[model samples]
Target: MMCLKTMMVCSLRQQILPILGLLLIIECIISLKLLELRVPSHVPLGTRAELSCSWQLGEHDVLYSVKWYKDGREFFRHVPRDLEPRRKFPLPGVDVETFDTSGGNVTLSPAVLETGGRYRCEVSGERPLFPTVSDHADMLVVVLPDHGPMISGFRSRYRTGDRVQVNCTSGRSRPATQLAWYINGEPAPASAVQSAIDKKTEDLETTSMALDFVVQETDFKKNGLKIKCLATLAPVYWRSNEESALKEKAISNQLLRSSLEDVKVTRADRVLANSAEFTNSWRHVVLLLCSMPNLFLRGLVWFPFFLQEI
Candidate 1:
C-alpha cells in the first residue's frame, strides 16, 4: 500500500472537544480500549519523530500508568500520579525531547536509521492488564527525504500583509514519511494541521504533507520565493486517508472556531477525550483565507481572511 506524509499547516483550534453526556458514559465503561499501541511503523535518518502510543481503562476507572520501551527497555513513561495524570520519560538510558502528555505521544528529534528496531509499550491501571499492556507497538527507520521540498500554489505574488501565502505541500503512498516547510528558503518550525480529505483508492492512499505560514513581501524576493512542501514515504499504509493540495488561504477565525465547536467528541472525556483522531485539510482553509484580499480588491468577499485572532 502507498502512504503520503503531509506537513499540515494549522493548530489545535480544530481539536474535537468531548461534549456528549450519554456517550461519555459509554466511554467510561470501556476504559481498557482507551488507546492502541502504535508507532510510526517507520523512521528516518536525522529527524525528529513522535512515537504515538495509547491505552484505555473503563470509563469507571482512571488511567494509572503508561511506559514505552525500545527493544525491551524503558524509554518513555507516563503515570497517573496523585491527583494529576501526566506523561514522563525519566529513564536515564531513554531519550525524548517532545512528548505531549495530553496527546499521549512521544517525540524524538533528529531520528535516525539506527533508531529503527522493535518497540514495546505498556499501559495499566485497575484491571487485568492494569500494570502492563504489552509490546503492541513497532518502530522502523529509513533514509530521509533527498531534497528540501517543492512549492505549489495558485498565485506567486501578494500585496504586503494581504494574506497571500504559499503551500509547501507533498503527497505520499506510504508511511515512515517525513514532511515539512521552509521559510525564506530555510526550514521552519512545525505547525499542527487540522484537515480531512476523501479517500478513493485502496493501496494508493494520498497523504497531504504541507506547511503554511503568513506571507511577507521579502519572501517573494528571496532566492526564488520558492514555497515548498516535502514528504518522505514509507513502505507501509497506516490507513486510508484523503488526498489534497496544501495551498489554500487561511480560514476566518470566527468561521473556523464555529466549525470546530460544532464537532463532537465520541469518548468519555467530555473536554478532550478525543486525541488527534480526525483527518483535516488545514492548509486548504488557510490558503483559501489568504486569497481573500485579492477577491476583495476585485469585488467583495464575505470571509475575512485578514482578521486576527482575538
Candidate 2:
C-alpha cells in the first residue's frame, strides 16, 4: 500500500511540473510582446486625425487582431487571416473611408467637433497554449478650434463726442466662444459690451459682441486708437485682431470753430458800440473849431467899424 501511494504521488508531480513549465514559458513569451499606440493629444476640427497602432511579439506568435474603439464602441477592426482583412464600423459624426484606414492605422478625414472623446486600441496576439494575449491603450481625444476668430464692424474713423458701435464675430468653432475687448491695450469697460450667439451649426457655434461707447476727446488724442477683439474658442486656441480708428481731428476742429463763432460775434457787437460813441464826440469838436475861425474874423471887422464911429 505505501509503494502504490508513492507511485501515484510521483505521477502527479510529473504531470503538474510539465504543466507549470508550459505556463511559465507562456508567461515569458507574453512578457516579450509589446503594443504601442500613438495619437495627438488634441485634434483640430476640420482636419485629418491619425490613430496609429503597432506591436511586437515572439517569433512564433501571430498577430490575431487589432481593434479601435471610441467611447467604448468599436469603430475599426483588423485581422490578418480573415475574409476581410480590415473592416470599418459606423461611428456617428465620423467621416472615414476605406482608404483612410490601412495597416492598423485609422485616419479621420476632416475630424469633426463631436468626434472628440475617449479612444482605445486593442491588440491581440496568438501563442501556443496561451489564451489570446492582449493589450490595450486608452487616450483622450480633444477637439480644438481649427482657426481663430474673425473680427469685423468698426469704422476707420471716429470723431470726438461721436457715438461709435463696434462688432466682433468669431469664426465658427466647436464649443462656445468667449470674447473680450481691449482699447489702446487696456481692458475695455464691461458696461460697453454686449455679447450674443451669431450663428450655430450642430455642435459648432459662432459668437459675437458689440462694443458701444461715446468717443471722448481723449480717444482723439492719439493718431490712431487701437481697439482689439480677442475671441477664445478653447483655452488652447484664441485669436485676436485690432482695428484702428483714426482721430478725425478735422471734424473736431470744425465743432470747435462753431463754438468759438458765438464768442467772436459778441466781441464784435461791443466794439461797434464803442466806435459809434467816439465818432459822435469827434464830430462835436470839429463843429466848434469851424465856428471859432468865423467868429474871430467877424470880431476883427467890427473893431475897425467901432474906431471909425469913435
Candidate 3:
C-alpha cells in the first residue's frame, strides 16, 4: 500500500513538471509584452515628423532606460545604472541624422522625408535577459481640391408684378451653402422661402435653393435694375471666389402703360355679348315727347294703349 502511494506521488510530479516549465516560458513572454514603447506616431508629406519611445517598470527599477531607432539604424540610447542592478540599455540603430538622448522624449524637429519611418524601442534589465521591444506608427499625407456651391435659376429678365424664382445650387461642397440676393449691387434681405430641392442622381445635381418674390417698379427703375443670386460654399469644400454674378433688365413706364391700354382697348373693341349686364349697359332708354311743330298744337295721333306700351 505504501509503495502504491509513493508511485502515485511520483507520477503526479512528473505530469506537473512539464506544465510548470510551460508556465515559466509563458510568464516570460507576458512580462516582455507588458513592457511597451511610445512614439509621436504619425507623419505627413512635406512636413516635419517626430517619433518617441518609452517603457515603465514600476517602483522596482526606476525606469532604467529608453532607446529610439529607425528601420535598422540606431539614433539614441539612454540608461540609468544608479538603481540596483536594475536595467542595462543599448543605443538605437543607425540611419538617423541625430541621436538625442538628453531628454525624456526623443524629439526630432525640422523634420524631412527620411525622418518618416518605423521607430523601435528596446529596453533591458541589468538582472533580466531578452530586451522588450515595440514599434511606433506610420503616417500618410493628403491633398485637397477646390469645391463649392453653384448658383442656378433666376437667369432671365423679370418685370414688376411678375412672379420670379431664384435658386442656389451646389455640389462637392462642405459645411453648408450660403445663398443671398443682390439688387443693384446691394445685399437684399432673405425673404420667406420655399423648400430647397436636393436631387443627386446621374441626371440630377445635389442641392438647389429657391426664392420666390413679387417684383415692383422700384426694383426695375433705379439702381440700374440689376439682380444677382449668389452662393458661397462652406469652407470644407469651398475655396474663396469673390465675384458676384450680374443680370440686368430695364422696365419702362411706356411698356407698363401700353400693356394696360392693350387690355382695355381689346375689351372695348369686342362686340357686346348677349348678357344681362350687356343689356343693361348698351341698352339705351329713349323718352321722346312727341310735340311736333308741324302737328297742331297739343294735337296727337290717336294710338291704341297697347301700341303705346309697345
lDDT of each: 0.52, 0.72, 0.50
- Stretches off by above 4 angstroms in model 1 are 1-31, 82-94, 127-131, 145-310
lDDT of 2 by residue, 38-137 (tens): 7665566566777776667666666777778787888878877889888878888555554333356777767665677777777776545443433444
Estimated TM-score per prediction?
0.34, 0.51, 0.36
In the range 190-252, model 1's lDDT, one tens digit per residue, is: 552324232324433343444445556555543234444445454532222121223334468
Top-down lDDT ranking: 2, 1, 3
What's each prediction's clash count? 48, 0, 8
Instruction: State the lDDT of candidate 3 residue by residue for 71-106, as single tens digits.
Output: 655566666654432222343222333445432355
Measured on C-alpha atoms, candidate 2 has an lDDT of 0.72
Which is the better candidate, 1 or 2, if ranked by lDDT? 2
Error of 1 at 292 (Å): 99
Model 3: worst 10 consecutive residues (lDDT sum): 234-243
Candidate number that wins on lDDT, 1 or 3: 1
Ten-residue segment with the worst summed lDDT in candidate 1?
Answer: 236-245
Clashing pairs in 3: 39-52, 73-93, 73-94, 74-92, 74-93, 74-94, 87-126, 147-237
